[model samples]
Target: MPLTSVEKDLDALTMTITADFPVPVRRLWDAYVDPRQIERFWGPPEWPATFTRHDVFEGGESHYYMTGPDGERAGGLWLFDAVDEGRSFTVRDGFAREDGTLNTDLPLTVMTFGFEETDGGSRLVTVATFPSLEALEQLVEMGMEEGTKAAMGQIDAVLDDLRSFAAELPVAAQLIGDTQVRVSRVIRGSVDQVWRAHHEPELMKQWLKGPDGWIMTVAEQAPEVGGRFRQEWTREDGSDGFGFEGELLESEPPHREVTTESMIGMPGDPARNELTLTPVEGGTLLTLVITYPSAEMRETVLATGMTDGMETSYARLEDVLV
Candidate 1:
């Protein structure tokens, strides 16, 4: 086991767990910050996790759930209190309801995760402070200690698999839940540059074209919360034309944005898209989480070769950045 020790202080209402990994501190840190990597080991063996939203910055929030073997699901939430880049982070952790809201009936804890380099690898020290002694006892009784150890035990495999999350890889999409998908890519540009490329009309017109034969005809940015944005594309031969428009619900500028998207001429409910940008080792890690109206809609969208088209656009984006 990678776990070095587990300590509990009833007097202080805190529990600390230390684990060592056979990788550099940066590698270890990225595994936790990236939703694509963390979801692989965040839950115990029997209860695999799916993160619908994971934002590692301060004031950010993450919502995830673990599915049991029999299809039972338990949800969780984390409110980031502080972030020190690759070194450490603090969060308010608590149970979440099915609607992704905090479950006030359950106990909440303030957890701090500290990362440091050791002789050959790195170490992670997690300290969780309970609000009361009863809360501490409640969580321990619910198998939090054993469950955490089981979760950490699976991290070694993820850490050793480096190529899967490398910067050179193309765009990849993972199903988060029945109605959500998380699309991830490491764009070959700084975070600010990438954000600008996405928001600026001229820059977007240059690289947001999905495939070789398609051209972006319109790129109207939302610019601010409550604003509306529209994008249209046409085939080279002027036959197939399509467009999408959305209202910006939230904007965090160079870090995060939330928008509602709908096909310009098509019918149905709009999709909620949450985009986040983070600086990583090689470039900017861009994550787009989309929530569809239903599972059928989600599957229909993915079946249209969406990921391949996204990969093509991102490859073009790299050249535009250069």
Candidate 2:
């Protein structure tokens, strides 16, 4: 009843209409067969309903009725050829008269329904095969394409909401690369001044909180190119905080310092943030290079989430330096 897609083949003037839905193929098939559920949005729900027969099995006959203010009647029937539970099926749809007799004006159609997972999501693909492309062209001239698009648009929105209700944890990561969010602020403080803040227990409490369940037992640093340091942020509730210790890549007192944290001892998975401090214009320019080992890893240190925390640390650093 709802068309999701219509891919055109202009070379042969052929088109394939598809509706990839989140619903199981069997559920979607049931809606096609059940007149009651079909009434919700089938064609138009504003029309009045007339008592009709609904037979939704392979060999059952279906008869339904609709009446308008102007005494109009519209109904259809489908003979299901196969019903596969939760998979796919085929059906033949045709129009019928008010008295349940077949209408010759309606063309019988063979619709193939498919259920699959597309890009980690469920999709129901339906394709109606016509007798020939000429019939398809004739329907195109009758504006079938436009109507189908409108119907499928509604169907897609419904399906999208349905899928959202299912609730999958969306993966979080920077849409752009990690370097994109990193900011470098040059300060006039010497490396010893920065290094002192890095190791101060009071300073640690002011900024970097350790893993959610862990506390920083120590904040130590070895000021050398190959030196290693360990810092921990602790929660009084005995929960963990985000903290790690990594080797220093480069170091020059009052000049530049680079360090890395594998984040093995933190609340989240492993990632590296390279912090650089350089002397510039009688001050030190601090460049932070946050290397997310993976997209998910990178999101753990988003600028938005870390803004307040980082600012707190910077303020504390200023206090200690001044």
Candidate 3:
């Protein structure tokens, strides 16, 4: 068991758990920041987790759910309060409803996770502060301690498997619930460079073209929140053209951006696209979570070889960065 100790303070209304791992601090930190790795052990053995969204910066949020053996699911949310890179981070944790909103009836907690180097490897200290003694008691009665221990017990295997979430992997998309999908890729560039590549009109025109023989004719980036942006592409022969336009909803420079995207001339609700860039070991991990109008719309979009096209464009982006 990786858990070294678990302490509860009735007066402080806090529960602190300490665990030791046989890896460097960076490796352990990456395991938590990367959704692909974190989901492996974020839930108990029987209730495996699936993270639909994970943004680690301050003011960000994460949405995840654990699926029980019998297909029952319990949702959770994390509102990031502070982040100190690999050292420590804090979040307001609470239960979430099926619609991805917070369950107000459940008590929320403030959890801080601190990491540091140890003689053998590294240590993780998590302190969860409840709103009140009653909240702490309620959680304990729900087997919080036992479920946490069971969850942490599976981390060793994830840390040892280095090839799974490596930077060399191609663009991959995973379905989230009924109307959402998470697309992930690692660009061989810094977070700033990757973010610029997506925003700067000149740079975007250079590498955003999906496959060969197509050229980007228009690249208009939204300068700020509530601004509109558009991009259009055409084949070299000036045939089979398409475009997309939308308004920027949220912007956190070099880290995250949220926008609405819809095909030009298509009369339908626009999809919500949330983009997050995080610096990982080999490069910057780019995660784009798209929420469509319906499951059918999500399927129709993905069935158009979107992932392959994205892979091609990202590969070109790496070359452009070089």
Best by lDDT: 3
lDDT of 1 at 52: 82
Q: For candidate 2, lDDT tens digit of each residue in 1-322?
A: 3444578665544456666555554345444433333443444334433323333334444455555568687766666677663466567756678666778775665666666655534566666666567766765785556755644554544433433222121212223232333444444476556655555666655444422333456677655678888776667885655556788775544333456666654554444454444332334445454556676555655744665555555644565577
Candidate 1 vs candidate 2, lDDT winner = 1
Give TM per candidate.
0.96, 0.40, 0.95
Off by over 4 Å in 1: 237-239
How close to the true structure is residue 274 of candidate 1, measured as C-alpha lDDT? 98
Q: Could you tally the backbone clashes for each prediction?
A: 0, 20, 0
lDDT (CA) for every model shown?
Answer: 0.93, 0.52, 0.94
What order do candidates take by lDDT, descending?
3, 1, 2
Identify the superior model by TM-score, candidate 1 or candidate 2. 1
Q: What is the lDDT of candidate 2?
A: 0.52
- Candidate 2 Cα misplacement greater than 4 A, ranges: 1-4, 8-15, 22-34, 44-51, 65-71, 156-322
Model 2, position 306: C-alpha lDDT score: 60
Q: By the TM-score metric, which is better: model 1 or model 3?
A: 1
Ten residues in sequence with the least summed lDDT for candidate 2: 165-174
